[model samples]
Target: MALTSKDFKYVSYLWDDAKAASLQGDEVALLLYRSNLLGADLRLTNYGGGNTSCKTTEKDPLTGTDVRVMYIKGSGGDLGTLKRNGLAGLYLDRLHALKKIYRGLEHEDEMVALFNHCIYDLDSKAPSIDTPLHAFLPFNHVDHLHPDAAIAIAASKDGKQINEALFEGQIGWVDWQRPGFDLGLKLQACLEESPGIKGILLGGHGLFTWGDTAYESYVNTLEVIEKYSAYLHENFGKKKPVFGGVKMQSLAPEKRKEQAAALAPVLRGFCSSYTRMVGHFTDDERVLEFINSKEVARLAKMGTSCPDHFLRTKICPLVLDLSPDAALNDSQALKEKLQPAFDGYREYYRQYYEDHKHPNSPGMRDPNPVIILYPGVGMFAFAKNKQTARVAAEFYTNAINVMKGAEAVSEYVSLPLQEAFDIEYWLLEEAKLQRMPKPKPLSGKVALVTGSGGGIGKAVAEKLAGEGACVVVTDINDERLKETAEEFTKAFSRDGFITAHLDVTRGDTIESCLKEAILAFGGVDIIVNNAGLSISKTLENTTLKDWDLLQDVLVKGQFLVSRAAVTVIKKQGLDGDIVNIVSKNALVSGPNNVGYGAAKAAQLHMSRLMAAELGGDHIRVNVVNPDAVIQGSNIWAGGWAEGRAKAYGISVEELPAYYAKRTLLHETILPEDIANAVFVFTGGLLSKSTGNVLNVDGGVAAAFVR
Candidate 1:
């Protein structure tokens, strides 16, 4: 893609005049706009890999004097979604003084304190480590990024030579250096050597582009990247890069998903050392093709594509075999297969840390791997939180892109082990790690909910997601399922939920949906059999079709889903939970509802049988019986509420109040009430209470346990 002047004008244009006027009053708004435009383009930067800054004038907090300020992206903020708060403003003169005297600050901690003290506003966030680099540069606007195409050229064996040939006198070059006060000095030195350079490429690091305006800096970065991409295409014939020579037989999408599901929990257990982690799997074409190469393990273990990526993905990925036979292995056998690999990786990391650490350096980081490569199945990114795991995954994905692009031209090279260590354990990043939030109770667990399009099922799935569990949602209704999945993801602020079109009555559909759930979250730790249908009719008036419909879905559907889940949990060897959403009608019969009542009774009995059979395997099965839940429920839709009202000789609109008044507490139940009951049972809060029935019917005497 070529850079154009039109792109600059578009960033300058604002949708709302008042809002644009407000932004124009503050220079940081233009910095944010250009930063977001650049960050939004995946080719430019990803995750938290980039920072942007602008030099402007703001009133001093202590005095009314108009002081020059430098607004830079703060540490740990994603540039694509950056807001005003994400920018850290510092008094320009103070930063300039620090640039001159920073050499006297021997410790990284001292430099951090100096940056904090120079804050233009006492309440502003801490500036990024690259703040000094932005301060020392003479340009009004600066943008620094580890763009894939730019990094590809920067990490090549002949990268410096290639850079010199491409831009000649207009671009400067700086070799790899630890990003702190010293790096700022090196950048200033490089600029003095080659004056008027439009951009600079940092060997083994990333790219820096700056100009008088944010638009000029943004376009220059794009122009440089576009040239590198064109060079790769010129030599590599525009083909998607992959690992060379290794190959795997392609399986149908359904089969591939099933295999990925079976492999997720095993990898999760094998990779974790102290705390459990969530796993996200990907089989994008490039990832598959690259891992399929014979050199996949060797190249993947070489080093990270960008030096800063070492903090997110570690020095290298943990490579595994997830071929068909490997995926089918039992827990004991799987552990045996993975133990040596884990041991080797840990030993390698320890030795690297020991060889590189200077006196007073931070202790060695956890030896566990963040990225995992499985040739046939693709890659897995593991983290304590789903969002962080995804960030790790995306960076690795970009790593492959750069490495492949570099290899197409020449050998793909990475920084030495010692350099990776310095970047990974930098004090600034260590501080951010200390500020991480406490993990949720179900942080690393995954759940599958059937009929999640509406009612109790949707409520249950959303509740689990809110509690930090990755949820797999399914429903026969496509539109409702999509809406539910969107709501779940937005509420949780993570991409940990997946939706599938599933009809519980069909074995094939049930099987495929289970695979989708497994691929999404690695494995299923909990399964809620909440899909249901009811036929309200007297036994004499009930037709065979109505009976079969209720029986097939209510009874047989739960059996199919439970059986499949048990097979996976047994392979995982982790304790699991299964909750069946039965009805209050199962405990007390209702007039003209023989089919619905009988089907629910059968399902309840089946839960008991499952509990008894799976007890030895540490898998618990429980039942939740709920009644008269009308709010946010689809069960009462399709005229069932009217039919029940007719039977009770009351208006349909009044039925909810009638049921509420009949309850012991005189309160109407909502779908969330049933969701809470299901959560209590599945969360191991009732760990020893298997083969038990919990009621969420607002205290019905007939439904109360004897």
Candidate 2:
């Protein structure tokens, strides 16, 4: 009753390799097929999560002799959302040679500069952060992905049992390690040790199987996954593909786009999945089947892709069905379904590690699923890069195959709860986490900009709000704030914009503004304390009366507002960020405005202390100093600049230009310019870096730079 390779079913699709390239023997036709196939996988995952590589030893355009250029899935692509140009050409020689570097690169920073060398298409956001994996594979056709069916298996309690049952002696298992040439080296060793090993399984991850031909690799993948599905079905006593529920069909691309445009915002907040239209394929077949199928539909009632898919996909999919409106109910249901699966997965690792580990043994890896599926929606897999997606899918397929087979014979066993926790919190996955490419993790996050009506504060807010953040513009000047909000509205849309009249100098107003923000979206994730005012005068010219006004706005105002935010943030336990807009006068001495500089300086140091104190809450605090943010700022254009210019015996127009051009890095400072600096401070990666000062001047401060 043991399962064999013959148990799986598949068909191979092929194109003539000789006709793949151009008339120059480039094999364009075959390459096109690989790209098409790769796109197909993206519909299954996200094309950015999978990889397609074409190796040609033919003469390069420059060398005019035998050379291999490996095209990898570049960063910023979603496999199901990829375009033709998404394939990035990597210098095959450089990649192959890099495969030989043995100096223990256990760091992603070390390889960041190195990968920049072989990148293709100057416009290709960045090479697939996983080129090294594709470079080292020794096969003609290598398609790696995190398939939905497979990730569910990999993340399950039954993964090891399933993989072993399906591949038996034919697959190579590699514990979760950071993927790169090192992983490549491990694969090579495993291949050598097991001469007949057909593919490699990256445990707690996804899939990678290759063949001498594209058709062979594709067929093996198809067959292996089918085998995996069978394994899941048999073990769970799952019936045949449930088809009697709904018979939904594809909507026109236009309709899909319209629906996606309307729904993407709500969906991202709900499922945290990428539903963009970037890949070559869309989710017509899968979506229709998922919604209509009785078996898969039952899964919607059950909840999530679970332990298998989380590695490539996340825990759930955002459903667009207006009728269900079930996230409020289903979210709790998902946690319920996840509990048993999680409990079982943990015990499996505890048993294996306790029995097999030695003092020198590597630590247990994560047991959480990389991808999750929604029956009426689609499957999603989360990976560090495209290559990770590839191995993850393969691992997923192997897990599914064996889980199904074992269930055919008897009930499948799952890992224990405690053991699964140990793996989920393991150091091995932590190592891999360090090697992941830096992304704008704040991408598509909405940032509400306070005091965005003008000046450095407005600039800082706009910058953070510009980089994919749904900007909610606020200012004491309702007219100005509305104007700022309208500029963005004209460019993006109403969904991307919001406006509120705010006076950050008041705690009650700040609190009400934030409440309104949460009502509009879900919660405010970023805060740019860019709302402040400066009163100008010499030390001798200044009065205690004017100083109090400056302190109230610069020092007390920021404190009162951020304090209110901390209350909500601490309760939510979210990674909320707070960026204070300070000035270079805080860092260096400022002319004439003695009270202004002192207030700014006090706020700057206060930012540092807040960073240290609130770090436990995972809230980040950073400061930005725009040496000169132009004269048209509210402070200048509001007649404050004219009086100050007269006091200095300089033309009002000359003062701001002097400040702007005086910086060592002589570049004019714009509001959007200052906003860019604020973005880096509040966005991801700076998670560990808080309590910092960023000079937005064109090198005027000369502090951090040179």
Candidate 3:
């Protein structure tokens, strides 16, 4: 059967012949190209959910003779971004020879250790558990994917019968079994029994397809997915109401967003009880549709059917008891109910662990649900980082599609609890978990740095992001803000930080900035009040407008930003930091600096008051006083440098040396020096200290805290 772009109604046919021709005869490169194409679409497979392989003739280093090598995606590698080094290469003959020593299913884990011995390239990456699923097959190229459409049929009550009818026996069917040597042999046997089959549907799992060439295998995988998708879509259309029809209406788009923002921090706080977790929210239409359906709670509780889905999203989602209307109308009541809901989910998870533990099973992990479903709003997914959190939500969305398709055709079925537990607590999975890199001190924290368009704000944002914090880089200057955003985007990627035009003096802009922070990375955990301006003038020379401007931006700005951020921090119930960028003029009496000095003094005192008031909330407020940060300082850029030089009777270029010579340490203060002080206050090192002042002006004696 010839297939074209028109045949792929549910999936995309992205094969570009010109691009394929560029790879030409390099087998490994062609395999990567094919794998990338299939992995590109979420409808085909999920991130890190599938593996691809090809057997190619290679020159053996030792024997200097041609030998067959099986190259497969390595452990923990995403096919979409896979590189040559991400593939594990093994001698085909050696992999085959392992069958002679295989101790059967109970001892299947031991095969993983033996795989190292068969490495064709000594520097090849570690082989994944699915290596055998491709290695044991006779085809030159193979694809094992977890596409939602295929899994829908695989997870249906009568999957085997449906698969037989759909493919007319061309694609075989295999019952659910954990992936290992035993399953590999079963796959081999299935192909042997059906000598002319193009693929096999694994009951309650996914799909496996193979071909003589990489293009053939890629097309075969797509055909199987598209066919299942078309069949499911046809059936879904016949069924007027999906998921038992919508029992509740979704809130309006804006209302839904407002509700999600209000709920995210509280949910994140509950989920992070054991360890800090980052959150991702989705009011995506598909997500809202499922949560609005009558069978949503029931289906979510039944859990996801795919192993890949559950591994990321957990066994099931925690469904909130409140509807969208109630959540919007009575927020206080919703807040009161959240704790009990979270507690119940945690208890349920603990019980699930207790009921399914084997003698040698790994100890229990955090007993919190990764996915949380609200009846009217949408979904909230939490994990160690933003990307993982987003991916978990994506995986669950795929599971929802599978359930919708399965229920439309027959009945959706979840893997048995015991089977899911066995896979979840598998020793191999534990080992993989252990191999992950240790997290940075600020790994799951989010920071909002004001005036980050340049100067100390920019440095502070970069430093925090480097230490694994998601930063909200903000400023009143739109042009500089965009430039800073571009630089941060290049340095940390978009996920690491977001840019916002923040005028801290205005309540509305401050609210908008905080809302941006909440939507981008859950909530703000650290606040760097670095935004300010300086007017060098005597009391007689300074006008009322000058005094008001300095007070509004320097003193009131910090106050407004802190007050807004505290609301979010309190909702999260997480410890937070507020580091104010003050100046030495606050303490030291100086000529031509009355307005700026008064604002600085007020800012310093306000920080102390906030620290005293917020201590009970575990929010630390500190001060960093930096003197003469002339280089890269935006305040210095706007004629303040010339004014300061005039005050000191020195040329503008000579001011840096004079300021350095004046400091006790005789060191020039840079923006980075001020940034380091901010990090010290917020980076968990001084987790116990608060209301303290750190001088970063090369030991300014007058600014030193008594």
Task: State residue 532's C-alpha deviation in candidate 2, in Å.
Answer: 5.7
Writing each residue's lDDT as its tens digit, candidate 2 over 1-706 gives 1123443333223334364433334433354465565555432344345666666655566657766666666665655445557667767777666645546754543564577776544555467556776677777667666654455455455555667777786766666554555776777777778878776666545667777655566566666666555555554434432333454444555544333322322222322222211101123453445544543333332323323333333222222234222243233444453455445544553565567555645565443334333333333332322234334434333333333333344333333333343333434444555666554445535576668776665565555544555556788987787676667667654555568878877877886676555434434567778777667787887889889988988899789878876754543335678888888778766578789889998999899899999998888888888765654477665545765676668897688666666778667787777767777776666778877777877776444523
Candidate 3 per-residue lDDT over residues 173-244, each given as its tens digit: 999999887788899999999999999989889999988888888888888888998899889847657998
How high is the CA lDDT of each candidate model? 0.80, 0.57, 0.89
lDDT of 3 at 268: 83
Tens-place lDDT per residue, model 1, 321-438, is 5564354546677778778988888898899889988786678867888898877667888887667777888888888888887887777897788778766776666778788787
In model 1, which range of ten residues has the least summed lDDT?
Answer: 7-16
Best by lDDT: 3
* Better candidate by TM-score, 2 or 3: 3
Off-target runs (Cα >4 Å) in candidate 1 are 1-26, 100-106, 237-258, 321-335, 350-366, 489-494, 646-649, 683-689
Highest TM-score scorer: 3
TM-score of each: 0.90, 0.44, 0.97
Clashing pairs in 1: 243-290, 246-292, 246-293, 246-294
